[model samples]
Target chain A: MGEFHFYTKLDQTLLLGVKAGNAEELLAGIQIVPDSSIYHHTHRYLHQHHYLSPEPPNDFAYWTAHVLGDVVLGERLWSVDIVGFQSIAELRQTFVNILEGHLASTRRRIDCAGGQEFHFMASRTYVLPTPHVAHNLAEFAHILNKVSINSLYFHVFDAKLRLERGENDFSRWFRSLGKTELAEKSSRLDPYSHTLDGLRREIIAMVEKHGSD
Target chain B: MARIEDYASFVGQATIDELFLLARHLEGKSVQNVNSTAVGGGVAEILSRMIPLLKQLGVEARWDCIKGDEKFFATTKKFHNGLHGVAVDVGDDEYEHFLEVNRRNAGEMTFGDIVFVHDPQPVALIENRAEIGRRWLWRCHIDFSRPDPKIWKFLDQFVARYDAAVFSAPAFAQKLSVPQVLIAPSIDPLSDKNKELSEEAIASVFERFGIDRSRPIVTQISRFDYLKDPLGVIQAYKLAKQRLDMQLVLAGGGATDDPEGPAIMEQVKEQASKDADIFVLFLPPASDIEINALQRGSTVILQKSLKEGFGLTVAEALWKAKPTIAGAVGGIPLQIAHKYSGILTHSIEGTAQWIKQLISSPAYASKLGENGREHVRNNFLITRHIKDYLLLFISLFHEGDIVYL
Candidate 1:
């Protein structure tokens, strides 16, 4: 195997100028927004509150439930297994379906206040390389303990979900290194269920135990 | 005097190293920051601190301010008020003068790889963008929720000339040709206003201001401006005091660009009345340590602004683990999660109710304070701010829409 270089992501959020005061409007914006916007609405909280446990709800569910006061629709939106989708298109479709279904079934119309309107936003990301590189399994586990949560998030959540890499950057790199056990353990982990800090701790533990084996 | 590494103690050494790594990506590009003032205001204060740190991190950064006469400044102040949804009649000459001042400033200034212009004061500088091919970003630092259509329409034309427009809050943005990015403002945790104060310092500051520490203190620290609703803060305090015995402290100073500070202060003083419990302190710009002591000494802090960019005072109070009650307008919601971190209020009644509720429940207020501090540390620190700005600068160079990791 060769050296595995880690990269981190920094995001700049750009407003799309498209806003929604009600569920129908929100659905329309969701349909037309770019893939980055879809990704942003889903993973926004994951990045912002990376230290909190039992990962916070996505912007869509939180706004609808808390702001819009549509508890049932909020539950439906929240229940969408984000990690189950292979691409942003699929994840976006799931939201579109849920919102469309709710708007059709429920005759209740809810409009947030003037400032409470949900602003459609997208992120322009800059992927930069970090100083950490691992030539072997021992080096990789040691470096994992020191890398920033952003680097860990880049390798885990960003690589797995946004890039549609079939697997996270760590598992893919591990597969290349012929460490099938470490790769499988990492591949089995879900990135959104826990905080990024929690995710890093779990991965570090998996890597360390694999090294001992 | 504080180095980039001095922040390592607050946000760890790894976070400091990440800044160095990010700066490496901008090795070749020079960043030039232009605003209206070099001191006093938030933009100037932020740049004065950030430019030196950027240079220390190996990025060539410089700052300059536009030279404007009293007429120009007064007109810009009108523009400022107009942008905050205030009605002000702006004549054609005022418009022409705004452009003339921008033209003079733009002609005299040298461009960098990236020219970052802050607020509406220097927005028209983008008119010269075609002559000089470089990335230009217009960062609006006002409560742009509801601007006067006349002023906004006039400024929108010049603003569209920029590569991207950045606002402090999501609601502040409008539909425009350029991409409107959202970047919340931040406070330096190590700065005088936000730094830790000793018990003696807090006590002395309280004594010097004649505020009795024996009783609970309810305070609002902000520029005594109309938009800040200092008079409303006094009313809320008076209402809350009807039920609970507490001291009200309203402390703030004026910015170099703003001329209405003394007038607003007078209004606040008259509203506060002769009640010794109601203390109105007009502080100097260099009184950050005293401000920190005052914030630390307060039992509950209030930022009942009718309009705000980000309500940075909320962040400052929350950073000190002081339970806060602020208007839900603008960026206050970002800092407070409604009874979770701090309380968000809509009117004078709501603000007063929350003040009473927070003071009545010590355990709940303490919990809110803890959550508020954690929230500020995670999202609103200078490290996160520098990272965001670095990302924004780097994205200007990249051509395509950056969706995939």
Candidate 2:
């Protein structure tokens, strides 16, 4: 596993919002581009993914209100009626609209500082491959080679992505993704192993094999 | 031998004879109870009374406690809270340490024909059951209605290995393959805590504690644990005191295995110190008679637990013919019949309202207490507990057979 650092731009932004002690800035940063950072993407993904028969509201509102010290905004965000939204995308849009309205109306705002340094430091930490990058076996293999992996969280994301696309075995899909050696190695991978470095090494070896081929 | 016939007066001759008949079936079977503490908490208190009674009834029963360091206890305390549906910090290290302690205890601990492992503390002891060749029963004394899924899943692995699981209330039971038995924990009426004390003894207890008996007394007797919500009790008392003059007694002791007791007790003391009427008595471990006296002296007994295993204090107060106002959680409902025997409250506001009602209407309070005592006598006494265990032990051996009493 890599050091406890923020690997995504969204994490850096959220950390800034957390440090700024501003809920408006945090919500602004979180909903910036919808899919900008893993944090933003994951929330959007989870929201969209479970949209029809979605689970209860995630901790976005709680983090916004409690951790970021914006009770008014948090309560407003939490009070958003998600009953009629048919998809996670629709829910995310509604949530963003509510958050934006709150942000515009609220007079309180914290001046966010030290973004560059925070970004530089966070770049060194491990972050899971984005859901988009992990959409397929080939893209997943490619992303795994470039970034540090958080194995447990990544596995869940990968499993869900695979289940959505009708793929189960990484090796079998790697064969279809045209990385046969990687697929062979993927079949032998211990899914239960929590070590990121071991998984990183396995991915690197498979990538090396693909490069040689 | 503390003969079954000795309990004739409290439980009646027929009940004793029925228990004796059940005990005869398991006359020579070895029954051992393994818990986390030997004193302090209800599990230890129950085992201390229960083991001897089991022995007297001719079931070769013994009690054993698991050995653990401060760290292990801290983890187990978190586990206890987690099992009660409280959000607790039970990380990987805490989990490993808990299992390591259990594994160590599992190696050294001996068993009986039927090993009764009480609560989550010593639950993993069933790992050694296969080798030891003993029928293990996991006796869960806490509410497991909505346990932290991670902790519950971890404990469930060990629980599934048991021959059967015992819960204090039907609501506390989870769906498991093993036969689940609802065995409500009981208070020994003959014990110092539940036994009738003379007016002088009761008055002396009030005098020692500097409690003013002139005003109505509201007492909550429980261990100094967050789950007991001692702070909430003080808040309820303050609310009630706004309308009526009452002296609140928060009397309890610490459990050896619960490391959080001292910290929680300090918080209780601070909250209680705001009002001079609220007396915080950190009673010593063996101060059962004092506890009994405090209950006897009280106008209304409060057990405002945020979460409860069984809240034996409710039964203890009810047995003494005192109207109890307790939280509507866990096994408290089984003891209290809501206005019929005792009142069950959901919040501090509700508790305060009931406290005021009970204190104002002395006639109604006395009636409730009378009903409560009968309710306890019919159900919550230790004689019924012993009979349940004997029946449970017999059921373990005779698996499919319907053992009629």
Candidate 3:
């Protein structure tokens, strides 16, 4: 596993994504570099953890891995920047390339605002690496069968993928990702992510384990 | 002194005197208004004018918002659909989301001596009755004669607990165990929308927008929500334009709680693009004076909402004596008395028919405007609204085991 690092974005330049416990304090203490822009924005203030800023003259995987890598693997970070590309097709291409070999994983933590919080985790984050993602839903299901579904967060950073976030309930589909391998294999075949036969069987087993409704 | 009077003169002396008379009875009582958003919608717009007027009248009235996130607002948006009789397949989680936001608001907001909770957004705040001994009223601003059962069941639990539930129209009221009052929402005749604009102000607005005063302008001012039906307004205008060479201005903005507005605006644009006579405006929330000038500059005003709580814009345009043709829904019927005051139409075809009638027959349109202004003055002015509220608040103080309508 590669060791994680952080970097901050000042204007167009990536400084370092710092891993300080208090993002507010880290932002206040950091001084602006001379001849550099005095970057002042709420997004910069709110975003504390930065994993890696891909060097320029990079491909889609660099931007995709740079953006999704931290959000998928990292905990305690509010946002992950994919860094913009000339077109979304290029970004999708990068996501496909990264999901080819490595199965990424991250431990779970609670995300809270005000006084309310909930636990979430992403065990595996990957891309389909195939064409016609939506129309060919069966092929995508085949890929889901191979990967361990125990991950909390899974994202395919495409406009088509963005629509599914609304179509599928985040909390319910997220829990379905934590199923056993046999159940996960079966769930991949189910049309709906939340209501697959395999996902149901896994949920039944989970409720039994936790002794819940 | 002239400037002070100029601003103050908007609400005429007669209206101010009437407010003072009503204010003396309920001088020290703490009145709290609870609603969805402090910006955008008509309820909030009325409160913005009314709260300050109430304070000036020596009443301690304050406004509070029900806390909600994007997900919760989505649920409330569903509730709005259901309340207005739209068929929506809202799930159990959506109901839970509504309650969750209400709980947050109930925990945060201070319940006053007279808590006037407005609309379905904060209706569930009445659940905090054990902590509050004062009057709690649920003010329903939408037409709810045929609300979806799924939403009504969830809202009924909260509304049944209220001391009283006030609806805009008699038809809007449900058969509840508690007393029901019909207090229609009013427009501030002195607000920016109805205030007298100088010729210079009107000309400047026209010049900035490249609108020529030489041609007659047909305008519809509303938020770009589906219920307002901006696309229908454009279609009606095109139908009316075949006879008269007039320009159409569809000017509106969106509300924070209404996420579907931008898409609706896009649809309106797609439809408006077919005709060069049509101008679709995506105005910001603070363009009140701009709206005033638009209304003043126009020859005919239309508010063709498919479903409305009470179309304050109709009263606003009517108060300015601009002949309006509004849809006959919600509280619009109360404002538009057919041929006497303003014209009310049921369909887009009917709206087009009336628009042509008003445009060609200037004498008839002038007479309608003359009557419309008097109708607003007699029934729908803010003075009348403030008086009704004072009386309603006073009625809440009476001790009775159960008060009957």
Candidate 4:
């Protein structure tokens, strides 16, 4: 197998020039804001507040709950199982389904203040290759501990959640190296429950544990 | 002197290495930062620090100023206020003068591979973009949430011509055709204003400013501008002083011919009285070390702004691990996440209560300070800012890079 080349990412968020002051507009935006916009609203807080534990709420859920004053819908949207989605397209469709169901059952359109309106944004990320390459698990464990949180974020969260990769780069790479136990354990690790820093530590610990065994 | 490597200890060696790696793609590309002034205000202060650092990282970066007469500057100042949604009347001649100044500067100046224009003052330089044919980027440093319609309309034409626009916050993004990138301004942790100070340095400021070192101190360091609401801070201090025995020191820069500054100072004095505890010291604009000392020595820091842009003072205070209270406006909320990192207040009453509460609860205040420092350390430091900018410059070239949520 080729050496696992580490990569870090920096996102430059761009306004989509479309915003939603009301639930209808928000639903419409969700349906057609390109996959990147869908990916952005769901995952921005993860990168922004990477220190917060148990993960922070996504922008859509926050807006519905706080801005639109629909706490039930907010909770419902927040409780959406991100792990079940195969791709951002599926995730986007899931949001649409939830919003459509709410609008259908209640048939009430809620509008927020101008300042509180949801401005759909598309992130233009620069995924640059870093200097950390590991040909083996020991080298990978050593290099993974020191890579920036952005590198860890790209591998774990962005890979599985945004890129539609069924498993994270680490898990897939471990499996390619015939490390089945390591792959399963790494893939089983949930990213939403921990900050990127915390997630990095977790992955490091998992790799070291496997080595010791 | 301020090498990118200097940030290794503060932001880890990997973070600094990432900056070099990002800068590799832009091998021989040059970035020219053009603004109205060479010094003063946030744009200049940032460029003064950022230019050298960019060059040190092997990107050919230089800063240029658009020369303007008093009329031009005055018109631009009104445009600035208008961009912040302030009510300012500007005439046709004023707009024409602004264009003439920019046109002249464009003619005289040499354009780099990427011509970076900062704020509304030099945005009109894009008129010559077709002739010069360089990658043009407009960077808006102010909040555009409620910009005046006329001002926005006038500037929208020039803004639309840019290859891309950069804003300090997502709220600042408008419905422009250009791709708008959100890049927040940063504070240099190693700068005189934000660096670590000795115990004696903190003590010397209190002695020099006549602030009693025995009692706990409450501070709000900003200009005496009406938007900053210096009087509102004084009112909050009075409200909190009902029970707390703390000294309030309102320190900021002075030496401006603007009549409003002295008038506000007078109002702040009248509200606080000749009370020794209410020391309003107007230090020189370059007194970063003094400001750092004052922030470090304070018990609780308040930004208490009626309106603000980014509010780096709050970040400075937080970096010192001091519990802070700031108005939940502009980019302040991004710095203070409600009660977690620091307290965000809406009214003078709330500010007063937070002030009193934070002073009384030492353990809670300490935790908030630690959290606030961590927040700033993760997001607002200069190294991360430079890396973001480098990525931004690279993005201008490789517009095809995909997304990550």
Query: If candidate 1 were superposed on the true structure by all CA atoms, what would the RMSD be?
Result: 3.0
Q: Highest DockQ: give the candidate number.
A: 1
Pick out the ten consecutive residues of candidate 3 chain B with the lowest summed lDDT: B1-10
DockQ of 2: 0.01
Task: Give the poorly placed runs of model 3, Cα more than 4 Å off.
Answer: A1-213, B1-15, B36-40, B66-74, B87-110, B128-131, B224-226, B254-274, B398-405
Candidate numbers, best DockQ first, in rank order: 1, 4, 2, 3
Q: How do the residues B1-405 of candidate 2 rate in per-residue lDDT, one tens digit apiece?
A: 355566888865645655555577776678888888887767887787788777777778888899999999988878877876678877898889888998998888767788888989899888766678888888888777678988889989999999888877645656677766667788887888888799999999999989999889999888778778887888888888899998888888774345677787778778776778888887887798899899999999989887666778898999999989988666776677566678877788899999999999999999889878977876778887886687677767653211222
Q: What is the interface RMSD of each candidate, in Å?
A: 2.6, 28.3, 31.7, 3.5
* lDDT tens digits by residue: candidate 4, A140-170: 9899988888899888878887777888999
**How does model 3 score on DockQ?**
0.00
Tell the DockQ for candidate 1: 0.53
lDDT of 3 by residue, A1-213 (tens): 111111101111111221112222222222221111111121121111011121111211121222223333222222213323323334334333333222223232222221111101001111112111221223334433332221111221111132233222222233353434433333333222232225534433443443322
Q: Pick the candidate with the highest TM-score.
A: 4
Taking the candidates one at a time, how many backbone clashes does each contain? Answer: 0, 2, 13, 0
By lDDT, the best candidate is 1
Give the range of the ten consecutive residues with the poorest summed lDDT in model 1 chain A: A48-57
Docking quality class, candidate 3 = incorrect
What's the lDDT for all of these models?
Answer: 0.85, 0.66, 0.60, 0.84
Error at A201, model 3, angstroms: 85
